[model samples]
Target: MYFERAHISDGELLAFYKALLYPRLVEEKMLLLLRQGKVSKWFSGIGQEAIAVGATLALDNDEWILPLHRNLGVFTARQMPLQQLFHQWQGSPLGFSKGRERSFHFGSRQHHICGMISHLGPQLSIADGISLAHKLKKEDKVSLAFTGEGGTSEGEFHEALNVAAVWDLPVIFLIENNGYGLSTPVEEQYRCEQLVQRAAGYGMRGMRINGNNLLEVYHAIKEAKRHALHEQQPVLIEAMTFRMRGHEEASGTKYVPPALLEEWARQDPIQHFEGFLQFLQLINEEGIHDIREALKHEIDREINTALAEVSPPVSEADELKDIYAPAPSPIPPVAGAATHDKRFIDAISEGLDQAMVQYPNLILMGQDIAEYGGAFKITDGFVARYGKERVRNTPLCESAIVGAGLGLSLMGYKSMVEMQFADFVTCGFNQIVNNLAKIHYRWGQTADVVVRLPAGAGVGAGPFHSQSNEAWFTHVPGLKIVYPATPADAKGLLLAAFADPNPVLYFEHKALYRSISGPVPEAPYTIEIGKANLIQTGDDISIITYGAGVHWALEYSKQHPQLSIHILDLRTLLPLDYEAIREAVTATGKVLILHEDTLTGGLGGEISAWIAEHCFALLDAPVMRCAGLDTPVPFAASLEKNFLAKTRMHQYIEQLANY
Candidate 1:
């Protein structure tokens, strides 16, 4: 049996069949544009039209839809203007993000389609987040996130399902198994025979549907949405569809077997649905032809409108804008808050407590955040203090943890989520890099999330646990990377992050948690996020550093009394303190950079290059960099010391001495 002959009504068949045809032909037009060289790339939802259009028809106009790059049918059936899609293909700025996003990668905050995430599995977690927000906000809206079979391999996919299941969030996770992920088949992608089987691990109901059958897809989505909204439990729908085209426009069907293609072709969602419509007798042959032509004309008109829209021109200002939303209420005067007589960890603990109070919507969610108090006990006592509702102790799913944070933030809550270790943040890379960082830029500030990581390499925590990956987050736009050197800065930065409209990556140095104690304010306060602190003022050399580097620089400065050093601690890395850096390097005439991250593509190179470009005339010597050797931080305390920047800081001072 090529397709399932379910109890689908004639009227339903007609509606679904027409849906399949209209979108298929519209997608074909896009293919023509691609062959004509009018579009750069084309990813048509050819054979898999039913899953896209059918699921959407069952969904409310207001329900959130997170489509993958291949769900072109969703856009076509949902009446997304064609000209805009064409403009996106044409690489026109006007088309790229008229409001939400370009063609295949799109979402509408107003329409409740939370933007599309180009990176696959992240959207699944984000869908959970959006669903969580709807529950918290008491909105009736449900979130639907789609991904391919290959996306299930990502940690984010599992994380999302588990979290949604645990919290009973209103999210529908649709797995579109199109047989191949790029060139890799579903069999090669996973050890599990059926992708839906994994849902049981999360204690969620899972269903598999004939993806080419519009009726099956529609009913599955409807049932999934019902479970999400009424039961408040997440549902996973595995739609076994086929990819008629290659992965992308440039790709060919050479890798796929002709027999399988022909077999799936008979189950062609569009053609099958068209035949179903004829069987139902809803419309004659002429009526179907008229509707098809009407859709083409409508799509063409939309495309033209998209072409006429305007986009911001490429300029240096585009780089600066949207990094940080106007700080919530301008920075108050530096009126000193009362100092709290507490230990470093105590200060952080109290600060987090006070932060939750100040911002009632703020939540503390992470693995063991409620009961175990996090791996490092940073979130210890939080669950008991905030209750299970706000202080959520998540399963050990890093991708879901971050994805849930992103979703919680979207619901108007300031979600402070923690990764047990900085090294583990890599597991949630799809959520962090693609979903959290780009959400604001793509969907226009729909998600305001804060991700806190216990980072750096001083802890003899071994290779997997000890890593400084701040440089990775810093590279992504729309993310604010903060590495607080002091417990006071940690408290202040975390507070500021809660107030931020954009996403913030607050990296706390693990070694500095208890080792470094400082005067923490008893009163609520937030330091300027992007501003760098000029700790020690001297004229000979400028030491540009951050995180643990700030502490190391101070140590080096103390050891070298004769040498005059100007230490600039970049509190924020993404929107660097370029103005302060330019002034300091100009005044000092010599520059020395330091960091604990790997030397390759580290922040040191960027600062050093900037000085060479802007402070060339002020320089008495070339800008020097001191960073960890390009190797994994060794486990032994002594070996780790030699492999990290703290050990090499003195050597840098010696280099600055000769210069």
Candidate 2:
């Protein structure tokens, strides 16, 4: 089948060559900077420059692009300054002196190049959702997401492709088959001979092209973009290219077979494309030499100019610059008294009902948030109460569900994404981490989104449904992690998160949904997102914990009369309550940190580090940490108990008393 190409006029062809030449020169300059220890690390798309240049030339400058780590070529084609790009690689605070962010997480709203993600495959889903948004908004823009062959292994790739195809979204999935995924070759990564065939499974058109051939790459991308913009159908283009450099500066080609490397080098995209230009008489040898020398001098001058620019002193006070959009006239907790009291499930239902009444743009989406009112029935009667538009059900794809929420949130919608079970959150981790958690930090605080995960291990849910994985998110900056233990706190935190300027991961302990009931106000309310709640006060010891552990610590305190256990219920885990913890630990002279996550890298370790550094002298004993065993939550009920740390409160108290 013949596919037509658009936007490859002589002017565009020249532009593609110019873009490739410019970026290659800068890449070489940056490589020298790395070797000289001026830059930290880099992943260069040295040999595959044509694919990036051609794809960008075919793409609309106003449209969105989500590139993977080895996409400096695409970024340069989009006119990202080589100097700023170099400043980023050099580990200079001036790289992001505008805010606190990493080098690779760069995206200019003005340029419409949605930031790049270091992780693999997840960007595909994000690109799909953003394209869906453009369609919904009736815009002509299309989205292009690029990844390696190895990224196809990720379930997110399948989820995003399925959604894009099913909805006929305007998105192009660019699979740059550069022979290998790091050290593993494409053949080893998938049994299929051609990566484009994978698109057929998603009901999308798939095509293969010679990525090393500049003309072929340009024509293929143009065809893909034409189909995307006009038909509004997703297409997958598998460009057979070669990786000429190591995965990163730290990685070496020592593991690669010498013969294989030699053969691939013969088909290097730059050399192949340059030869093709000569064959077509598009440019002579003198033109090629002039372009190369001009690009090198321009890049060299840019590097010197950027380096000469003063590095703004990084101030500690500036740490809060883009943490979250400043709350517009603080959303004070509702002043009215509680008319009715209920469990966590009822509180969430009531909060959603209230939000629908208040904000017309608010949306509730999850596996069963609409008809089922959520798997745990938290949104029970929501569909009937607010209609399907406000309360929506989604396909089983968690990544797409969350990515869609992010898209809606970007369009000024108050979107809440629900994960039926916290343990299953790994399915959407890429969406949460790569897109939602870091969006505001990357975009300079323009994103406001909320994701709710029903977490904690209980009720014999087994490994797939029961887990307390809050620690994984707490470790990430620019994401607010909240865990509410009671019905009142749950409702308050949910409202606060909606009002919050940044993305929030609201972790609702599944066991506490209906297990614990409390008085909840009907009006709008907000409990501070980062502050800890002192549930009880005592002298001898302080039990610092959050979520289900707070209730467990209280129970232990009741069981033991000798130990006066002060319990601090940390509602928000990310922006930890260091001051409150210090005061409590200093007053009590001892500390015991507890959580439900696995012991290693758990919240307890972070809390222990804080107490050790801040309250060392007041310690009666070394801080004690009690967490789940470092193993998967088991399927068997008895084995699950063994894996969990329930009934350890009494044992922990006894140990603390002895210490």
Candidate 3:
């Protein structure tokens, strides 16, 4: 009944009408720019303005919004400047993404908005994490995440909803059911009668409404927000509408039937809302004409101003900026016999414990990490010390864990995520690569998150459990990869990673968890990420390696002291210490690069190539590499021994020494 009348105040009704008009005017201008070859692309929300405007207006100012490409009205409702949007479309530096991204792929930290990636549903899990942060901070604010009907089919959607429901986080999942995903109709996408029905499986309330009715969308979202904030629960609202325009400006609607298009056009939300405003006498025809003309003039002026502005300069220095946060001030090393000789696992646990105590904003999330102390007992006694609130044991969903960590990091929290096994990281590869690795470069935002990967093979864990996957992440920019070979380095690097303002991937060799023990500092200490440690010095040859390869090199050196070999442990894989590498290569005049990862396409290849290109004159012989065979790790111990680099390092060193 309330939907049949003017439920809001006269002032608010007029404001909503203005919000509806703002996007239509701007989008029409964008279409013109596309036609004139000024803008690259435009994803119009012409028919579904009500859903974006109503849902966004229902939120508090402190609340956050994770918008999709089609939700331009959300930005309009937030009062984002028209010039900024036009500059973004024009690829100018004044844009939110600093000209790094194009249309609809930008966000504002000031406005508490997140940019969208082409990957559709990952933002949902990220919103779940932000909502968790709000709940933990005891704030009443809720986060609203926008996605299309097609996104509901992604596994991340189910994982996000389940996590939010389990934790009772204050998050609102708004699904804009616009009848098609690009071109495929909803009937072919899912067999369910309604997509909102899936919410029952996640133990959340679900609501479906006529998305074209602006008043119904507004009221439904207001109620959903109330439930999320007051009850500390998530709610899913499906606003049924249709995409009147093509997916983008260049995409024609040839796939959509003419009769269906006519039916949706007849129910346009802007026209319907204008009729309602006139019926309530809130505005007259003259007033409507004034509003439309004023918006058009304002948009035209902004577009012209943006076009007149100079574009951002392209430079070689700009290519290197924001790849990593500035290195923290050096901490004085504590001199001692060692506070305690601890195993690798104990050192890592102690490091995490000390970091949690040092920074209240630091939180830990992983499977069986809280009460169970993790599968490897690395986090033993953590929950008892830090409580279940900070030390959270998440579901067996890697993508959700990583996505939520990214969300928490965005909200000024340092999150440490643990994968049950390093091999399981493949499940979250999309988030790690697309979102975590690109957030800073794409939008000038920090993702202060650390992912702990238990890696290596030696305990007969087989292929699934044993993997040295650091090489997979080294190829990705904006990511710092650390491989610690000792208890002390493990403790130091973990602390450093927590303090860093960028995303870090820490690989802890599973074999060294207990087998390796050394004296560690009693207090927190940080080892610079890009610096490598010179394990031993000699003149015959330089053995370059990291992780388990460090141990193999040490054993080979000790067994063949007559060879006088030098070993350089590369702790950080991405920001490698080229100076240290050059020193090693120059000193020995012969080099051998070794790693535990597979031979072809391994990190050793990069190091070897660099040595060949930069240190060619310093080399006495061609650089050689000893690494794992190009095959999956066999389950048998006998077969595994032959598959590793340890078997061939000694032989390769002898041949290089003879040369």
Best by TM-score: 3
- All models, RMSD in angstroms: 3.3, 4.4, 1.3
Off by over 4 Å in 1: 1-18, 96-103, 138-141, 190-193, 304-313, 319-326, 333-337, 457-459, 556-560, 598-600, 629-631, 644-651
Instruction: Look at candidate 2 and tell me the lDDT of residue 614.
Output: 78
lDDT at position 68, candidate 1: 82
Candidate 2 regions off by >4 Å? 1-13, 31-42, 96-105, 229-231, 246-293, 313-330, 356-363, 383-414, 430-447, 462-464, 536-543, 549-567, 586-609, 616-659
What TM-score does each of the candidates earn? 0.90, 0.83, 0.98
Write model 2 residue lDDT over 581-612, tens digit each, in one string. 98889768878888888899898998899888
Clashing residue pairs in candidate 3 are none
Per-structure clash totals for the candidates? 5, 0, 0
List residue ranges in candidate 3 displaced over 4 A. Answer: 1-7, 336-338
- Model 2, residue 590: distance off in Å is 6.1
User: Which prediction has the highest lDDT against the true structure?
Assistant: 3
Ten residues in sequence with the least summed lDDT for candidate 1: 94-103
lDDT of 1 by residue, 456-544 (tens): 88879878888998888777877888888887787777778777777788888888887888878777778778888888899778888
Name the lDDT of candidate 1: 0.78
Which of the two candidates, 1 or 3, achieves a greater lDDT against the reference?
A: 3
What is the C-alpha lDDT profile of model 3 across 515-610, one tens digit per residue? 999988889999999899999999999999999889999888888778888899999998899999999999899999999999998999999999
